[model samples]
Target: MFDLIVLSVFNGLIYGLLLFMLSSGLTLIFSMMGVLNFAHASVYMAGAYFAYSLTPYLGFWGALIAAPFLAGLVGAAVERFGLRHVHGHGHVAELLFTFGLAYLIEEFVHLVWGRNPLDQRPPPLLDFPLFTFAGIDFPAFKVFMIVVALGMFVALWLILTRTRIGLIVQAALTHPHTVGNLGHDVPTVFTLVFATGSALAGLAGVMGGIHLVTNPGMAQALGPIVFVVIVVGGLGSLAGALIASILIGLLQTFAIAVDASLADFLRLFGLQVTRATPGWEVWSITLAQIGPMLPYLLLVLMLMLRPRGLLGSRDS
Candidate 1:
C-alpha cells in the first residue's frame, strides 16, 4: 500500500509538471493579451501529429526539435494574420474566434492524420524501465518527460526574469501603452509571446503524445483538463498555475491509486446500510471510478471558494 501511494505521488508529479509546461505559456498569454486561447490545445495536438509524421524521417530527437518550431511558426502566422485582424473585436470575440479555430483545426487534423490513434512510442533508447520500487517499474520515457518539463521551466524562468526582452514583456503585461510610448514594438512583442506560448503548448503535446496516447480526439480529451489547471491555479499567475497543476495531478493520481468506497468509510463509523438504496450505483461511489472527475470537482470547488485562485490577483 505504501509503495502504491509513493508511486502514485511520483506519477502525479510527472503529470503535474507536464501540465505546467502547457499552462505557463497559457497564463502568460492570458495575462498579456487577455485572450483565452481556445485553440491552444489544438496547437498541442498539431505538435503531436507533426512529431508523429517527422519521427520516421528525422528520428525522435529531430522531431522533438523540429515539431515545436513548426508549431511556433504556425502560431506566428495565426497571430499575424488571423488574430491581428480580430483584435478589434474585444475579448469575447477573440475567444470565439479561437474556439472556432479549434473546431476547424480538429477537422483539419482528422482530414490530414485520419480519424485514428497513431502508434506512437518513445525512442528505442527510452523504451525501457528507468527504475523500480517495490516491484513497480518506472518507464524511461516518464523520466524523460520530467527532464524535458524541468528544462523548459528553467529556461522560461530565466528568459522571463533575466533578459531585456523579458523586462519589456513584463512591462507590456501591465502597461502596454507605456511600453509602446517607450518606442518598443508592443505588437511585435505580443506576436512573439503568443507564438512562444503556442510553441510551449505544442511541446507539451509532443511529449505527452508519447507518454499518453495520440489520437484524433486527444486534444478534445485533454483540453478541458488544461483549462481546469489554468482556472484553478489562477488567471495570469504562473506560480498559481504550477501549484494548481501539481495539486490536480496528485489528486487524480492518488484518487486512482487508492480504491475505496463511501460505504467503506461509513461502515468504519458503524453506520453501514444493509442494502443498496434505489438509484445507488456501486461504481459511482468508488474512488477509482470517480478519479477522473476529481480535477473537475476541485475546479468547481476552487472557483466557488477562491475565485482568484491560489496566486491570481484577477477575478477568476
Candidate 2:
C-alpha cells in the first residue's frame, strides 16, 4: 500500500504537470486576448506531428527545439490572417472560429499524417529506467518530463514577474487601451502572446506525444479536459490553473486506485447486493470503473458553488 501510494503520487504529479503545461498557455492567452482558443490542443497536436516529421531528419533533440517554433509560426499566422479578420464580429465569432479551426486542424492532420497513431518514442538516451522501487520501475523519460515541466513553470514565472515584457503583459491584461495610449503596440503584443501560447501548447504536444499516443484524435481527446483545468482553476488565472490541474490529476489518479464499489458501501449499512439484487449492476460498479467521470462531477460541483474558480480574479 505504501509503495502504491508513492507510485500513484508520483504518477499524479507527472500528469498534473503535463496538464499545467497545456493550461498555462491557454490561461495566458485568455488573460491577454479575452478569448478562449478552442483549438489550442490542435496546435498541440500539430506540434507532435511536426516533431514526428522532423525527428527522422533532425533527431529528437533537434525536433524538440524546432517543432514548437514551427507550431508558434502557424499560430501567429492564424492570428494575423484568420483571427484578426474575425475580431470585429465579437467574442462569439472568435469562439466559433476557433472551434472550426480545431476541426480544420484535425482534418489537415488526418490528410497529412493519416488517422493512424504515430510511433513517437522518446530519445534512446532517455529511454532507460531511472530506478526500481517496490517492484515499480520509474522511467527516465517521466523524470525528464517532470524536470521540463518545472523548468517551464520557473521560466514562465520569471518572464511574467521579473522581465520588462512581463510587466507590459500584466499591464495590458488590465489596461490594454491605456497601454496602447502609452504608445505600446497592443496589436503586436496580442499577436506575440498568441504565438507564445501556441508555442507552449506545442511543447506540451512534443512531450506528451512521447508519453502517450500521438494521433489525429489526440487533440479531440485532450481539448475538453484542458478546458476543465482552466475553467475549474479559473479563467485567466495562472495560479488557479496550476492548482486545479494538480487537484484534478491527483483526484483522478487516486480514484482509479480505489477498488471499492457501491456494494462495498452497502455492506457497511447491513445490505448485500448480489447478482440477484434489483440494482446489482449499478451497485457493482467500482471506483476504478467510474474514475473518468470524477472530473466532470467535480467541474459541475465547482461551477455550482464557485463559478469564479479557486484563484480566479474577480474582474476576469
State how far residue 166 of model 1 sits from its true place (Å). Answer: 1.2
Clashes of 2: 0
Best by lDDT: 2
Query: Lowest-lDDT window of 10 residues in candidate 2?
Result: 307-316
Clashing pairs in 2: none
**Segments of candidate 2 deviating more than 4 angstroms:** none
| Residue 42, model 1: Cα distance from true site in angstroms | 0.5
**Ten-residue stretch with the least lDDT total in model 1:** 275-284
Q: What local lDDT score does residue 184 receive in model 1, on the 0 to 100 scale?
A: 100
Task: List the global CA lDDT of all models.
Answer: 0.86, 0.88
Model 2 TM-score (2 dp): 0.95
- The true-structure Cα RMSD of candidate 1 reads 1.8
The sequence of per-residue lDDT tens digits that candidate 2 reaches over residues 157-186 is 889889988878878876789999999988
